[model samples]
Target: MANSLVSIQILPKTKNGENVIPYVDEAINVIHQSGLTYQVNPLETTIEGELGQIFSIITEMNERMIEMGSSNVISQIKVLYQPSGITMAELTEKYR
Candidate 1:
């Protein structure tokens, strides 16, 4: 079971005022490549994994934005950590 649920909304400032959708797509790609369970929502992407691993992924996403020519990046993050364990499905089961 995962120990953390992290939802991040990355806003990357482009070099030439380019559209941000592509940059956002790339960030989501990074998360997808991580092979962790994730859900991509309209405003944010939520990931399920060990806390450390999730943070590492977040860092990589930021680095990717810079590498892709983002002048700066702002990440809005929300975390729910439980040492015992937690999963997105478990948490949203009632809604489903």
Candidate 2:
């Protein structure tokens, strides 16, 4: 199966103190619970996995953040599927 790349940008209600970090942590926790491998970037998060799992995890994270008091959560995604697996084009085609 090809891996899809996920980029998620999370902004909390506040930029300073533990406010944002807590929400970030909560979001990360959602990713972890999703059973997918991911990396945290400076202003974004990257997750690589199956298309379904990737989308599911991102949605879960966004919902979790909202439950944590985040008014707005934005997500961007890119999947790099290999020919042997599912290709990015295929994933997009399926979703689109």
Candidate 3:
């Protein structure tokens, strides 16, 4: 079972005040390419994986924004970790 859940909302400042949807898409690509289980909500994305991997992906996403010419990036994140191990489904299935 996965031991952690991470949700991230990334806002990258666009050079020349360009639209940010494309940059956001690129950030999402970092998570998508990570090979971890994930869900994309309207405001953010939740990824299931080890804690280290999730943090790494967050750093990579921010770096990618820099590479894309973003002057700055802000990431809002939420994390839950269980050493005994927990899962996304286990937590949310009650509502589902």
| Model 2: per-residue Cα lDDT over 1-96, one tens digit each | 545666677665643334588888888888877766677778877776777777777778878877876677766555565435644345458676
lDDT of 1 by residue, 15-89 (tens): 778999999999999999999999999999999999999999999999999999998999999999999999999
Model 3 per-residue lDDT tens digits across residues 71-93: 89999999999877877898899
**Top lDDT: which candidate number?**
1
Candidate closer to the true structure by lDDT (higher is better), 2 or 3? 3
lDDT computed for candidate 1: 0.98
- All candidates in order of TM-score, best leading: 1, 3, 2
**Which residue pairs of candidate 2 clash?**
none
Give the TM-score comparing model 1 with the true structure, all chains together: 0.98
Q: Is candidate 1 or candidate 2 better by TM-score?
A: 1
Q: How high is the CA lDDT of each candidate model?
A: 0.98, 0.69, 0.94
On TM-score, the leading prediction is 1
TM-scores of all predicted structures: 0.98, 0.67, 0.95
Q: In order, how many clashes per candidate?
A: 0, 0, 0
